[model samples]
Each structure stands twice: as structure tokens, then as C-alpha cells.
Target: MNQNHLTTLLAVLDEGSFEGAADALRITPSAVSQRIKALESDMGRVLIRRTSPVAATDAGEILAQAARRMALLQAETDVALERSISRVPLSVAINADSLATWFQSVFSDVAKWKHATLQLRIEDEAHSLTLLRRGDCLGAVTTEATPVSGCDVRELGTMRYRPVATPALKDAFTSDEGIDWADMPVLRYGPNDAIQESDWRGRLPERPRERRVSQIPSSEAFLEAVRCGLGWAYVADLQSDPLLETGELVLLDSTHVDVPLYWQHWRLQSAMLQDLTQSVVDAAKQHLS
Candidate 1:
């Protein structure tokens, strides 16, 4: 494969358009288009889809992932030779709740490393593996224990979420038959979030009908909304512990959700990635159950 062509393909995908890629590569838009066409001809496949903010075909993703790996290797070589080199990009997917809590330690640790730059894609823990599969991220902090193809997986730890609400909200909703599930407002991280419903199903005889739901996509905001009595939610113990201690939030029940998280990354022999994986593992041990 042509290294220049592979680099061009990655540039186009990253910039989302040929013109943008041309500008980044210090070349003409026509030159960018021609290079893409030449590369496609060589590979005998349509690697990119022509659309607004263009997307890569599956073939393109495979090559783009290869290109990213090659770039990282080159950066490492440069560092070993004591040659000037740009910081290597380390893209990883992480869940919002983790980002709001224990993952901050990873950020602090990365800040002191000068040879790498961190790029975080915040997705739900259960679904972050998709980013890794699509080559959108090099690694991910996901709830998936199964390893993705060409990747290695390690157990991080479990994050515990408690069904909690403000004291006022809990009192108003609680009754002899337990809290009024149907009428009480509930908070969720997003439509895809089912922690609240999952907990309720295990505890309740049947699913509630026409339950009121509010979506707060951000982790910090979701906790704050629950704190302000906006609605009850399965809040992470890391964030709720202080509030629970200060009497700002109370557990709605004895039930808690324990989500096991795993670290999945490509099996590569790079010192930078190894160091980063260690940092993540160390942090998870200190923070997670």
C-alpha cells in the first residue's frame, strides 16, 4: 500500500471533506480528489462515501486504522532517535459517568506526559465498543468484557449506582405500596440508558405504565438534577457519596446497580499505550468497587 495515499485517506476522513483535507495537507482540492481516486483504484474498492461531512466505507476504516497505527509507530521511532516530532494522538472512548468521576485521574496523569495527546469520545459504557470496532477510537472504557477482534481486554472494576433522590422527592413519592413509580418523575442519562428501568424491573412486580421521564445527557448535570429533586435516578456512588453524607441525597431503596467496566485496546507493542493502560488500571482499582 502507498503510504502517501493512506495518509491522504486518513486526512480526508478526519477533516470530513476533500477541500478541508487539501487545506490541511497544503495541496489543492483537485490534488486531494485525485489522490483518493488513485488510492481507490489501487485498492479496487470504494473507500469513502460522498456525502455532507463525508463518511468512510468499511474498507476505508480498516486502512484508516492502519494509517493511525503507522503514525503512532513513526512518532515512537522519532522519540527513540531524539528527533523532533509532533505529539502522537491517543484517541479513546469513555462513558460520561466515568469521565465525571474516576477518569479524571487519567486526565491528570496524561497531562504530565509530553509525547502524547488525548482525544476522548464520550459514549455510553455499554455501547462504546462500537467506536473501537469502527476504528473511531484506539481503546475504550466499556462495559463489554468480550474482546474486540485484534484487541486485548482487561477487567477494570465495577461502578456502583444507587437509586437515589432528594429527601423531599423520596418522601413525596413513597407510599405504603412503595414509591409511586407511575406518577413520580424519573431521570435518565439518555433514551438508551436503562439503569433506572432495569433496577425497577428487578425490584417491582411489573413495569410501570406511562412513567414520567426526563433526559439529562451529561453526567454532572444528571447528578445535579437528581440533587435538586428534579427526579430520581441511579446515581454513581462516587458522585453521590458526598451528597448522601451531607444529607443532600438519599437512597430510594436498598437496591444498587453494579456495572462491570473493562479496558479494551489494540494489542500493540507501544510504550505509550502500555503506560496509559497502567494509568487506567491503577485509577480503576482506587475508585471502582
Candidate 2:
């Protein structure tokens, strides 16, 4: 019933596990469990199904939506009241790839401040706009060419990706030209992350795998998997550069995934949103190469 309970429930639903949810929310799993129990008791129904990967029951789905709405409202209220400072909390919905590649510069620039807090939601670019529509986020970095209704848009930059692999994987590929790198365990983004994948296919003479070898949802994990030398993957150039320099990775070819990024924010009169957008835009120009 309380906002804390709603936040905890939302965390559990977003993370899909008690431990992950607890880690994200900065609370113990026992506390998360208690919050969910209290919420279920108030709602008079079992909300989330207790399973390996947690799933929302029909009722839980309703609560999940409601919780997101409430979190937005409360966070906005807090932001509004604490607006005396030059910096304010900025909640942004962003695709994993951007967070992995370019947005880190923006985040790092803001981290030095005492008053700027960012609540980030990891989502697909294809769907990040929905969070803006629901008022759950003030800004989003998205791939959509058109701005969401009732929002302002600014081009942050474009991200380029290339097919890459470890030296061992590359050697293996070279050893047998008959071997399909596509069939090789290629780390991929969750769904529809193939903008880069398509580029890789065109760059290659032929594809061996009908589908990706592995699908990783998180940016950090995807890059880690590739670094661990478990598989080849399409990596954003901005993100791949450091790994390449460290000799931990190498590019397979010049083929690239070029995804244009746009910064979208509510068209309302929120100074914090405006400042955050400008900060990101400035950061992009410096680091999105």
C-alpha cells in the first residue's frame, strides 16, 4: 500500500529474481519478500509467482503497471520539491547498448555533482518510448526517428558496431573457411538487436547459423561474455575500442551497426530535464565517436 512496497514490487518484477531485485533496490531479500507479502495482503491476492525467473500473475501485472505509475509520480514530486539546487534527479529510460557504449560518459560527467541523481531503466530502444508515454521517465535515448508525442527530441549521436571475436575465435574461423561464424556462439542483445547482426552478415561471405548463438539482455554481461572469449559478438565501436586496445578483443571486419540515437524528453517545463538533455548532448559530442 505504501510507496516503499510499490517500489520493492516494481524492483522484483523488473529484475525477475529476489536477489537481483534486492541488489537493485539496495535492500535485503527478506525486506523485499516482506514488502511483497504486505502488498499481496493488502491486495487480497497472490501477485507475483514464486519461481526461478519470477513472473507476474495477471493481478501482479496490474500492480506492476500501477507501481510504475506511482513511482513516477512520487519521484516527480520529490524532484519538484527539491528544485532549489541547480541539479535535480533525472530518471531516464535507455536501451542497453547506449548505456554500454556512449552514455557512460554522460553518467560519469554528472556523477561528480552532489545533487544529480539518475534513475536508469534498462530497456530496448524499440520500447523505451513507452516509459516516456507512461511518465515513468523524464528522458530517453532511443533509436526511433520520430519523437514521441508531447516530447522534444535531439540527436545525441550514432553508434557503430562491428563483428568481432577473440584471436582464438578468429583463428578458428580462418582455419576452416567452411565454418560459419554465425553458427558460432555470437552474443546478441535480447531481441531485435540485429541491426548490427545484419551488418555482420553482409560483411561476411555467408552465414552458418540460422540464429544467434546466445542472447544476452544486459550490456555489461554481453561485453563480459565476449571478453571471456566464450563467443563472437557484434560490439559497438565506442565500447569495443577499449577492449581492443587492452588486447582482450579484436574486430573481425569493417562491417558496422550504425544506430542513430535521439534524446527525447517531455515537452513540459522541467528545467532539470532540459539540463540533463544538454549535458547528455554535450557528452555525446565528446565521446560518441
Leading candidate by TM-score: 1
Relative to the true structure, candidate 1 has a C-alpha RMSD (angstroms) of 2.0
Error of 1 at 200 (Å): 5.2
Instruction: Candidate 2: give its CA RMSD in angstroms.
Output: 6.5
Q: List clashing residue pairs in candidate 1.
A: none
- What tens-digit string does per-residue lDDT give for candidate 2 at 191-287? 6775645655665777664755677778888888888877887887877788899887887766666778888887766555666788899978987
TM-score of each: 0.93, 0.66
Worst 10 residues of 2 by lDDT: 68-77
